[model samples]
Structures are given as C-alpha cells and as structure tokens.
Target: MLSPKKIRHRKTFKGRMKGVANRGATLEFGDYGIKVLTCGWITSRQIEAARVAMTRHVKRGGKVWIRIFPDKPITKKAQETRMGKGKGSVEYWVAVVRPGRILFELGGADDELSMGALSRAVAKLPLPCRIVKREEL
Candidate 1:
C-alpha cells in the first residue's frame, strides 16, 4: 500500500502534467509520420527559419521530427565557458530532431540514407546540434 504523502505527490504531478498537456495542440500527424511544431524558448523568428528549411525536405516526402527546447536564464560564468560566443550559452538549445530512416532500412524508391539525410538537414539548422545516440525502437 502507498503512503498518504506518496499518493498526494502523485496526484500533484499528474495535475501539473495535465495542465501542460492542455496548453498545446497537435499541429500535424499522419499514419506514416508526424511533424510537430512545439513551443521553444528561442526567438520565434529563429525557430521558424529552421522549420522552413526542414519543411522543404518533408515536402519531398520524408518523415521528420522537430522539437524546440525552451529557453532558460543563463549564468555569466557558464555563458563564457561555452564554445560559441555568449549566444552559444547552454540555455539555448534551439531545436532537436530525429528524422526517420524507414526508407533507408527498407531500401525504398529513393536512396535510403539516414546519417546523410540527418547530417544534411542538421547542417542547415541555426544552432549547434549533434546526434548523440541511436536506439532501436
């Protein structure tokens, strides 16, 4: 049996999650894939530019996933330590994506190339980003 405190804590967490879930609307979804335009902390102008670049490839018929990390206040010490200028502060993770590779794995009509496609798409993005890990799903 769960303690009273634990039950209360779980309810509170669920309530918070429910509130956040209600704020956003699902922009797009499909049987084959989905491209969601979510809220992020960076400037909308910057985010839109990246979206436009990715959209071009999607229009050509490929699965693409996009997510924008919300902006947060940065400390001066940390700001100076980063690789880029003050702008490259850790708080600014503009966008992250996991472009699908079903086509490549199946050897479809187009050349199925996951790494190449992901790299090319990421190259056009504004912020510094990389593919950290890969996992089977």
Candidate 2:
C-alpha cells in the first residue's frame, strides 16, 4: 500500500467532487494513456496493483507514469462502537479522482503493446476508464 511519509493532519473533513479535472486531463508524459471516466476514491493498494500489472505487461518495453497519488486520509469507525466519539481513526489513503483525469501514461512502446498493458491496468482499478492516445488528446 502507498501512503504519505508524513501527514500534517491525520483527519480531514469530507470534501465534494464538484467538477471535472482541468489539469492533467491530457496525456503529457506518454504517447498512450489511461483516462478515468468516473469520479471515485482510488485506494493506494489499487494504484499499486495497477502499476504492478502494467509493469509486468510492458516487460521493460515502456515507461509508465502514475498521475494520481493517494494523499487523502479516510476515516472509519470500529464495528459496534458508539456513534459519538468524534469522527474516527484514519483507515486508509485514497486519491480523489474525477472524470477526465489521466491516471496513467505509457511511453516508448508500440500502440498494441501500450494498449494491452493499459487494459490490464484498467482491470485493477475500481472505476471505468478508457485507453487513449496522444493524438486523441
């Protein structure tokens, strides 16, 4: 699992996802990319799993860039616990993703290879995504 080395605050208020991604919406680092199509919380473990799948599929033929990082800490209460003891302990880290966000980028590989690797990565993610190319950006 991926987590911040240091956190200024352990608990934070729940924020709203109100708009589409404005920045990092285009493929900048690679010729092919995976663009997220839904809004959701992407866990750190899921990101690592996707990365491993892509790396194994690429087999050193390309470079992959992970655009999102799990920085937000989510809290959860213990089962059978009372409901009034503040919020809850931080349970895990997640990246809040919105529609139109480019989650991963692949470079140095041919179209077929990149697409295959990206598709494998997509299976590890929790939300729906699309494989895109630089020209499509």
List of clashing residue pairs for candidate 1: 41-70, 41-71, 104-112
Quote the positional error of residue 36 for candidate 2 in Å: 0.9
Residue range 38-88, candidate 1, lDDT tens digits: 322233344445445545544555555443332223223363375655333
Report lDDT per candidate.
Answer: 0.33, 0.93
Model 2 residue 105 distance off true place after TM-score fit, in angstroms: 0.5
TM-score of every model versus the real structure: 0.31, 0.93
Best model number under lDDT: 2
Model 1: how far is 135 from its true place, Å? 1.1
Clash number for model 1?
A: 3
lDDT string, candidate 2, 27-83, tens digits: 889998899998999999999999999999999899999999999999999889998
State in Å the error of residue 18, model 1.
26
Q: State how far residue 58 of model 2 sits from its true place (Å).
A: 0.8
